[model samples]
Target: MLWYVLVAIVAILVGVVIGFFIARRYMMNYLKQNPPINEQMLRTMMMQMGQKPSQKKINQMMAQMNKQMK
Candidate 1:
């Protein structure tokens, strides 16, 4: 009766929490293995924008990007 309903609600809550954590972990690993951006892509983008890309600039951009992601 009421006990069965309580169990069902708890089970649903637990499942939701577990699913959220698992999905979060998977996404974190995926991002680490394959970052959203790379030096080549950044260079290409800068060139397209009419800015000559330099190594120093690239490194700075990468640092900023990583900081934001973290």
Candidate 2:
């Protein structure tokens, strides 16, 4: 009986760890394929805020955002 209980606990822990990694990897891939935001979206947001987003400025902001993500 003690052996069974121990085995069950070990299985549960291993499952939890594996599930966590699988979910994390799935989300990372999903986000990479469909990023939370993009250049066009950023440009629109800036324009809505009454800021004229030049291409250079947009590139800079995008680079900064990517840097922060890393």
Model 2 segments more than 4 A misplaced: none
Worst 10 residues of 1 by lDDT: 61-70
Cα deviation of 11 in candidate 1 (Å)? Answer: 0.5
Q: Write the per-residue lDDT of candidate 1 for residues 2-69, one digit (tens) a residue.
A: 99999999999999999999999999889978998999999999999999999999999999998987
Each model's lDDT? 0.96, 0.93
Q: What TM-score would every model get versus the actual structure?
A: 0.94, 0.91
Superposing all C-alpha atoms, what RMSD in Å does each candidate have to the true structure?
0.7, 1.0
lDDT tens per residue, model 2, 13-70: 9999999999999998887788788999999999999999999999999898878766
